[model samples]
Target: MATVRTLRISLVCLFCLMFIAGFAYRSLRMTLHSASSGFYLLHSAPHNNSSPASMELELQDLMKVIEWPEPPGPIDYNFSTSPFKTEFHMPFPRATYYVGEYVEFLITARDHHGRLKTYGGDYFQAKLHSPKLKAGVTGSVTDHRNGTYTASFLLLWPGQVEISIRLVHSSEAIAILKDKRETRPDKVYFYGFFDGTNETMECNVELAGPDICKYLDAQTGESWFCKKPKQIPCNAYKGHSAGQSQDILTQKEASFLNKSVKEKLISSKVGTFMVSPKNNTNDRGICSSGLPNPNPSGFYYQDFWQSRVCRNRAFPTPSNVTKCLSGKIIYMFGDSTTYQWWNFLLDLIPSLQRQELHMKYPAPQLAIDPENEFAVQWQAHQRPLTMKYSDKEELHYIANELDRIGGAKEGLVIVINCMAHFISLPIRFYIKRLRSIRESVLRLIKRSPLAKVSIKSGNTGYLYIHGSDWLSLQLDTVMRAMFSGLPVTILDAWQMTSCHYEPHHLHPGPVIVKNEIDLMLSFICPK
Candidate 1:
């Protein structure tokens, strides 16, 4: 009985030892496997069945994954049966992505065959539809370089988008490529304010070029490039090169002497000039010439004398005039003669008002007041105002400046006058420049959400006495036609100065200046 009991105890002890050994062996094996492999087993099954080839195959399958969601019904249609597939590559791949976001089911298709038809040059139509928005179409293609038919679409709102590309080949065989892409909610970019008061507002559109840098260096003005030279300067002497007189005038001695003489002459005649007084001899009209003659009361002398006299005494106190242009910028672009008109306007206004000045070449006297509500700037090149080169260059500069101002939330009021300087050239050239200026202003207005344009008609007839009547008639015709269908508001200085002529020249005396200012005031500030 004792021997049998001992044998039972030994059998039990042996079984216990085998169980411990088995557990140790299993733990060792697991440690070894973990060291050799790069996976850990937690609550799920171990992933040790994958091979490199299998991984590659999985990636390929992922690339072939259809962008669309699973169809409602199963179908046996094969992609191989499709006639053609259209694809596009974005030159800037990163542009497809925004920071801190991900897009799912982004589809990019390519045609195995490179033959596709196009219309209107190389433009192709791209249609995009979103689940929550109206369908949109690309208006035109920038280029169809080689066989690549590329188009860009912007996802402005978060939703599912369906992309459809159609290659129109002749009247038939319109190839269609369709894909649906899911875009994650992305922050929509809103540029400057679009309020009617702000000038920088623009409708949302897909941009193709480089992002415009808004913060331009203010210290460095526009980089100068040599434009086509002008044949004749606008106010150059008959024999001298067109713009050469500017260089001559720039000399210290000449400029100082000329300015001194002008100031002295103007100051001496300030109080002596008569206002727009009625003629004593006849009731023909008020004269602007101020000189009493045999026909002092006649229409010619009376009107001339009155215009000059009124212009001298018509200075308006700032308090009396409504400050309609207290914070707006008004640009006056033209030649030196235009500068004179601006100066005259400034002088007629109260000195307490703020103003700023800016000048470009040839029109060195240009000035403006940044702080003034009614600031004016003049831009003129040395070339003859009639020359296409001058107008083109001036327009380019104006466009650039307008772009800059448009970026800011400021409205622009432009007044342009150029015909007086260009009168020497063929009428056609003048018309061309005028048209170019008009087009440039129109472009500026289109770009700027808040802009008003006004044009001062040519004052050509006022400068030549003997030919005044004929010149006036011609100017009247041109002014009437030039401003006919346009938005430009005309300021007629020619008729205002019609009767007032310098003793030997056509230059309007002080009286005409007053008449011109009154006309401007009436238009600029009604009532």
Candidate 2:
């Protein structure tokens, strides 16, 4: 009896310890999920040596690469970088340039007071383009950290090309954008509608307190919160919609964002010069996955993107596009940019039919080419989206959707674009979200090594206070860093949009989209 009582007591003590351990683990997971962008959760498996601790360590490494340099002085319009005062000129001017040669420009940043800047933090976009030919290529900008920079362009086309440098943002303006973006999660608001009532309340990713209603995704641990409706219960929340954009910049800060300054082209002394092709035949290797992105990745000549990274194959005709897509299962997930790819295909392929699921605006869509035996689907990635109104049920996290596919099958092509909507959020949130997607991608690849995964880099667009090209560049930097070493194809839309002669747009026009899709197809049909 004494031995039995002792054994029973010992077993009870062991069970209590196990319960306490489990509770601690659960609390830690919840805290991480709620604090960041819900990248890790209590229920998700630890695939391939990836644990919470391991992920945190990896994040720290990425943080170092994306760390932005802070401006040295206080906000003063007189001290801010000025596009009108700034000037760029060819450091080594030549009467004629040959293909495969580089054209370098010396950029001198100046303040509104016409004084040469003594420090560097200003954001400038540089490109070489031929307006008549509709040809352009992004130039590489090298900051000297001493108010001077270098814009280097690789001459890929044989024609007259002009150099352009645009001041996207002054260092002072960027300082304001950075401060508000990190601390002001409520700057961009959303609305929550209550069922059976006309009442709508403000909703957001960071709303907290006892009087708010929270909607949580159990699988992913993602949460959305809204101010509780006075007349309806929290469960009555029926839909989500984008609300007004509240400007946080003061009048003085707005001055830095003036039309004359923001995205304004700087004075250039260089004129358009002719470029002669290389003496020998230039043959680029065939397009394939895992190829490193070349500087200025590709250039436009005759309105076609000539990729330095791959020997791009064109699907110029509708029949050509259909043939390449046949027998393939394509899944595109993210914002409107990814949707544009699907739309482009639908318009291009005459035989492709849209399978109407009665979806709403910015809805998940399905299209099939029955004769070709191929299917394509596009879904908007979850919250931080800026749609005027979208059903909550339609928004799904990219990582969750990737997992549902459960180990990629043959002929599967997954293209992901998640950077545009994430620019307004904190950098850590973007990092965590990308980390989760990276893990999911790894799982898919591990199961089947042949899966073709492509990540579309965010493009240059939006010169406003809310979604600036600088912000897009910042997140794009993090995204590339996070996915480094992975066997994925980066679509290089950043370079594609930056170099294009067309006006900067969040959703680039058909000409640019055509190049983007063609580049994607090159990877799929490299032969």
Candidate 3:
């Protein structure tokens, strides 16, 4: 009996040890696996099924993903369908219409295959420019996903309004644009700073290496990490060339709007009032101050931009502009668009001569018209700037720069735009930055009520896929909403640039620059 009891106790001890060993083995495996792997987050929404209820659910989900989703896709459909040409014909051709009547038509496209591209994703630009009436009105194009699309316009100006269409980009080209933005870092311009008085070093995007110039400004406490330039004191600096500009997909490309699109003109009178095409006398949203037309004021052409506001235009002539700007001090803070605006003003007003200021980087691109006591200066904002500017020590935060300006004098014009550079960053950064700007502006107004402040709206061109246009528009919306609550005037460049037929760009054509400047003058000396 004693021998049997001893044998059973020995077996029990062995089983207890095995259980503890199994538990510990599992714990060890879990720790080792976690250490060897990485974790990431992803966001997605699904869509597009036939049933009505399901369709609604799908759309709801998609809207949550992209407020405006692209035309329902083969989401990966080949852009090679290649739109060759587009034709616009009034469904039941109308001879004329009353003022403000909507004119609609069907635009058909045939691809390189000469097949009516049943799957729609082609980009087409349409315009209603009547040189005879001095009008250039932009119209909208809607794709039906059936190769047929809709073009609509409201006839605000009564004249021989002619229609024209051009193919901008095929859906395929846009796809390429979308891919490049995500897969490549080339489109973005980056900056970094070095420490301990690195005399031979400067921030350059051209370099490629593992070691980046990581810097933090001691005074402002701003931190930045930049890619190294080609040659560096830190042996690791190598620069990457700035991204290439998007090649404008024109007719010269494999596909374009078919050459058969004929110009259509509306020569009839609007509501029995026969108006002269030479001058668009109609007014709807025109204000005496020449603020942007609140209503759809078709297009008005007078060589210079004609706002819907009544003809009480400010600075109607070059000399008129000079007189209006006399004795004013202007400060500009922005990217290249604002830079171009400064250049335009310099050229238009000859008396404003470029001064030989010794300070190079942040000296403020200044021009002085001593004869008129007018001075305008443009300082490229700190980093993420489009050009390869030398990052100088004097570079100050925009808000700090604004705070430093002394009590503002009457006739002080401040033009500011912060779009192109900030596009690549997360939207939160932009929102926080603008909120800070709003506070600064409010303080400025508190100190000097007579000083003028203007915020330049973002232009349309950058696509959502490329962190521009659709994406930039969102930021623009935030900017407008923030400033709208403030007392400053907003120069509505978005509508002016978006509505016209020009290829959208960071630097718009000379015509756009002129219109923008003229509008500025209107606010400075509102008639």
Candidate 4:
């Protein structure tokens, strides 16, 4: 009985040992398998290595290289020095050369999975990069399904030129990308009088911009006649002597009246007429005398009457002029020159009403006629006392007023002309004020979606005070710095009126004012 019991105990121990050994072997195998497969032993299967979280790839892998065009001459168009390439993928290369030149580039890229992919395209854009060069050229290739891109560029000038190229690529993931590129070519050319032909003279006198022409006309005291047939001068007055007489009325003074009648007749042909009668004794006689004694031996006065009468044939009146600003809100800011613009606009369009906003000290409010078709509001925030007192306080007041006006929700055409006031100040201080004003204006425009900001560079024609020409120069320099990045249309009034000035002060006369207004309007309503 004792031996049988011992045997049973031994068998139980062996079974226990076998079960322990089996469990140990399975655990060892699982640990080795988990290490090799990069999976946790506690988990059933290996984690996906292709998942975004598991892969450590950069954006460069997905980007493709762009091939650039070759240089025109023996010049070394070094594009390898540019820091535009990606670590993992190649960059889209761009180059600027002449029109008939060939451009070659290599684009090399590798995917995250260690697979290579290549793509290329060619194209060019036309844009002028130099004032001397008249035209520009560029070309590119599209439809890259065939795996090749051919680009070409050509320089118009034969002289020394500088060219810049840019390469760009966009990618959101590995092996997926888009590329875009641009280039600018600058060429040197000489421009001067070619010949004395009428076309060449016309081209030479051709205005840099309409503003320069209008300003010249205005400075020369010419009228800005609107285009209306009824307002135009009669054709008969084109070659008619200013001292000529007419038989329309029977009065000794009728000859003088004919002079006026002649003016009226000429005025009827062209909608507008410039009245700058020359100073001469004949002009007085045309106004005073009626009829001149006819001479049979020398000149036949009756023979001239027939042609004059034929030329005086009248035409039907034309339609009324079209209104420029129907319901638009045109806002003018700055000093007297701005006021000149406001007045010119008001004189041209009766629909415009002159309004004022008085901001006394801390608070400011805008006042305007709601029923008026157009309102010309002027805010001349000049602190004459601030020159002797605290300029900062004055600037604060100006900024507050600008903020209030700029925040208006209406469709606004804001014209700004400011540098004249702060020209005398130190450059730093002037820049500070300009920056503040710019920021305030920008904030206002950003707040108002319908605002179109037009900035007039301070008028050089007029100085703020006597002996302030230096101030105007400083003001321009400061303005250029302040408006570097802002999307403000700069109206160069100073350069426009560089040739002329008012009698004693720098203020431009009515003609310059009109021309400046026309120039401003051209930008406001471009043709």
Q: Quote each prediction's TM-score.
A: 0.36, 0.88, 0.65, 0.35
What is the alpha-carbon lDDT of model 1 when measured against the actual structure? 0.34
- Stretches off by above 4 angstroms in model 1 are 1-315, 318-322, 349-361, 364-374, 385-411, 460-476, 500-506
Query: lDDT of all predictions, in order shown?
Result: 0.34, 0.79, 0.55, 0.33
Superior candidate under lDDT, 1 versus 4: 1
Q: Between the candidate structures 1 and 2, which one is better when assessed by lDDT?
A: 2
RMSD of model 3 against the true structure = 21.8
What tens digits encode model 2's per-residue C-alpha lDDT throughout 1-527?
66754644453343334334543564465545542222224345433335779878877887787666567868579888888899998777777789888889999999888999888888889989999998999998888888999999888778777888898888888888888888988888888887678877898877867677776665555677888877667766656887778888788987877777788899976777899877756567887777888787888888899898878888889888878876677889999888988998899888888876676658778777766667788889988777857765566678877776645346778899998777777777788778778878887788768789999999888554488898888899888887877899988999998888788988899999998999999999898
The better candidate by lDDT, 1 or 3, is 3
For candidate 3, write residues 25-96 as lDDT tens digits: 533533343211111001011111135565356444433543322334433223344433445566765554
User: For candidate 1, lDDT tens digit of each residue in 1-527?
Assistant: 56754544443333334334533553454344331122212112212234557645644443343121222232222211112343443333332333113222211222224334232111133433332333222222334333343454433223344444433221111111011001110111112221122222111111123322121111112211111112421111111112211121224323222222211110011111111222233243322211222211111222322221122222255433326454445566665555666676566555323222222344323333323333445555323332222222122333333333443234346666665543323333344344345445656766773565656555533322112222233434454454556555565454343223332133455555555554444334533
Off by over 4 Å in 3: 1-66, 71-81, 85-87, 108-124, 132-134, 141-149, 170-186, 190-223, 227-298, 309-316, 360-363, 407-409, 422-435, 459-485, 498-511
Pick by lDDT: 3 or 4, better one: 3
lDDT of 4 by residue, 1-527 (tens): 56754544443333334334533553454434333212223223322223343222311221111222222222111221111221211133333334323333222322233333233221111111222322122223232422232222232233333222222211111001011000100010111111122111111111233311111111111111111122222110100000111222224322221222111100001121112223322221210111211110011111111010011111111111113343345656666667666555556554333333233321111223223333345545433111112211122223434554534454466777666544333333344345446666667767885566767766543322121333354467456545655656565555444322222245666655654554455444443
All candidates: CA RMSD (Å): 38.9, 11.7, 21.8, 39.6
lDDT of 3 at 103: 75
Candidates ranked by lDDT: 2, 3, 1, 4
TM-score winner among the candidates? Answer: 2
